[model samples]
Target chain A: MDKETQPPAASSHPRHHAVPPYLLAAMAACDGAWEAPESMREIISSQPTLDKADGPVSVTRTRIATRARQTMLLDQALLHERSTAHQKLTWLIEPTGRLNRIISDAQGVEITPGTLIRSEGQKPSADIDVNRAYDGLGHVYGFLADLFKRNSLDGSGLVLRGTVHYGEHYDNAFWDGTQMVMGDGDGEIFNSFTSSLSVIAHELGHGLLQYTTNLQYQGQSGALNESIADVFGALVEQFVAGDDAAHASWLIGKGLFTKAVTGVALRSMIEPGTAYNDSILGKDPQPATMAEYVKTTEDNGGVHLNSGIPNRAFALFAKALGGNAWETAGSLWFNVIATRTLPENADFATFAEQTLLQARRDHGAGSAVESALKQAWDTVGVVPRLKENDDE
Target chain B: MSESLRIRVVRSGGVAGISRRGILELPAQEPSGQQDPDWFTMAHQALNQLRSIQEPATAPAVRDAFTWSLNIDGEDHVVPDQLLVGPARTLAEHVITLRGSR
Candidate 1:
């Protein structure tokens, strides 16, 4: 079939997937509902006496209500996932109302409203770090939810879980497959990574990418992925803080470093290399233009280094678009990432093309998209395919 | 030697204010080391003047060192070291020192 003419496939699987009438009725009575056999089994197992003992009608009703609430939460989670996948939006719902039994192993820990764990060595410093992580996550989550109407990172009402003081002097923050882990920075130059809103948002952006494009974290595609996080992270900070392009500092880790450090910031979106200049860490190595781009192995194929190019592109785009960065430029980038069919190894050229396509689709095929696209790529020394006689 | 108190006037936090911390060892008997009321009033005045001079509109016109000031008793004294300047984190330490010293 021709690609343009192909129709969306209708499922041919058995039609035994309808919600039971009783279940539907129960769900309708409540705000919402969901179903997970594993959760039900765990709940039932936890209250095995319910199976053996003849409880009062109220007791049975309470159990049913509890199960229904769990189901509702699961349903919400599913809905959030579907919405995020289809709409490029996130969802946030309180998890306390749900009945999912969380379990953890030695290596992993579950984060929930009630689950509290002490820090290693019972250090007071660890408590501070943990609290900061929690606050930072809450802020970023609220920013995404309030500003974009997103439920969560996955758009599937997923709980935002963060592990604080992860590892010994990890020196970085990262999103594992399931949770966000923050490292306490070395005391000399950096502090707790959780101190900055942008860093939290950046890690969450990684989760967003995983759910959306699942961009491979290597080479140019990796750089694009990293750049996407930085762009959104910076925008999240500005949006939540009510900062505008002119007023925003455009620094990634504006408050993550200690006072002893003489650097400007972790990274600068507007002026790449100018973020910092120090003797120990060397000058900001990021190159704003394509001519000076560094080809290195550090930072996962120079993920951080090459990111400066796209970072500057995003900054320029935001400045030209004016107003809040998240309003137009941010929306454009988010939509492009959501819609682009990116491979794991997609490079800068691929990203540029997809962005151009998205810009045209979003803003019309006019001078605005053309100029923005050209300027962005040209600034990074990536030559785009030219249209014949367009200059005239 | 007459006793003198060394007072450092540190300024931090603005659009792009840096974290600057400096010490001005004053002779304990310096004229500005008078009573607390006179010292505070002078410090307030000096801070106000410094802020006025560092207004966003005229920030570029003022030199970096101009951001710092020393209040002696009831008079303003300018200092040489610009102290801390740059991003938020860089200025955080100066804020700590200023608060701690006072």
Candidate 2:
């Protein structure tokens, strides 16, 4: 029939053998009643030449023989075996080289990967939220793979899955263990969750942290988890914008607010507690240093609030480097995480020490990187303090 | 005197990491035997259910999900967003929608 009426092609399926588009169409036209495998039929119909004139009688005879030969290798079991072999080899050699993104729609419900709306290599969806989620995942994946040599969120080519339009008036995005969930926001205070790339990267950051250091999600460790997420969020935004440390705005979730809200973003890395001062939303309560650390039982011991301390510290460190934050400071922090020796319940000081250690390992013991890291932690008032259990 | 049930829901976490406080008081147990409002009835049932479950000692493993600190009357129960369900979820939603706190 027509291209619009044709079933969407599964062109990216690894098992689909490479056949020239025009040839596949010509073969399909000449086949008449020749039955092909289900997957092969899908591939043949997707070719543009099917709508054109059928090939000559001589060409049809050749096409039937060629198709019969290829059909032997196209058996379900044989195809599966070949694909598995390819997968194993790809996993070992270059896991992070390809993108495997899947974006879905939740239809304003709290379900994940709700309805498959988009997949990797597909054209943009009609919905902006779906397209944004798709593009945002690509951006974050590219940032990690290009800068950090990471293989997706799990560092092993884990499929980047996401759901958009999650929950009614949902004003947040999150990583629910396996996939990313984006919300449409209440629209009064915040706009669509996918509107900001930093926000998307921040959620993906949680996934990265889970696969890496897995810092406990409470108190200081939890705050560090949030801070690192914010750091990566800011870094991804800066990397995409080509903004160096000094030139970056360092705002997380920037442009997420509607005009009615009296705020710029969710949090400010450079100047904590100043992201918003809305009468309805209240002032942002982030602390720029340890002295202002908020001790509370709510929000998992104020993980979000206290994270500002480390967030500010990172921003300071990156600014001190005065260049690509992702290059030096970001690399050092990621290196510390990749080591996987940091305690799950590591306090800020413990994390700071790990970073210092990593910095020394990467840049010499007395290098400027080490000094800048030390100064950043010092500026944030994070001194190495033993945990209560450690004191024992 | 008309009996009133109070609900204080503090929703925190999420990508924004903002904490929102929504406090509400609704008439309950009408002396005239009139039925209580849906919120009051739901709150009563939710409080009982919430009290029955043991409070989680550790933070929720899910990242960026909201944590809800719910106080009914003077009693306190903190429930992570993932665990909040049934009547408690509805009651909390109602309170937040009604108050829209700062």
For DockQ, the strongest prediction is 2
Off by over 4 Å in 1: A2-126, A367-370, A385-392, B1-102
lDDT of 1 by residue, A1-392 (tens): 13232111112112212434234224222221122223233333343222233345543433343333333333343455576563421212322221111111112222222244432223333366666655666666676565544456654456666667554543566666566666666677777777888887887787777666667665677778778988878988898799987788999888777787678678898898888777555577778987877775434456676788888888887777678888667866776554333455777777776677556544566757557766867776776443353211
Say which candidate scores most in TM-score: 2
TM-scores, chain B, all models: 0.29, 0.78
lDDT string for model 2 (A198-305, tens) is 999998899988887788889999999999999989999999999999999999999999999899999999999999999888899999999999999988899999
- Cα error, residue A55 of model 2, in Å, equals 74
Q: Ten-residue segment with the worst summed lDDT in candidate 2 chain A?
A: A4-13
> Model 2, range B1-100, lDDT digits (tens) per residue?
3468788888888888888788887655554235445565677789898988765676445798998989998899988887799999888877776654
DockQ for model 2 equals: 0.58
Model 1, global lDDT: 0.55
Tell me, per candidate, how large a share of the native contacts it keeps.
0.00, 0.67
Chain A TM-score vs. truth, each candidate: 0.68, 0.75
| Residue A85 C-alpha lDDT in model 2 | 57
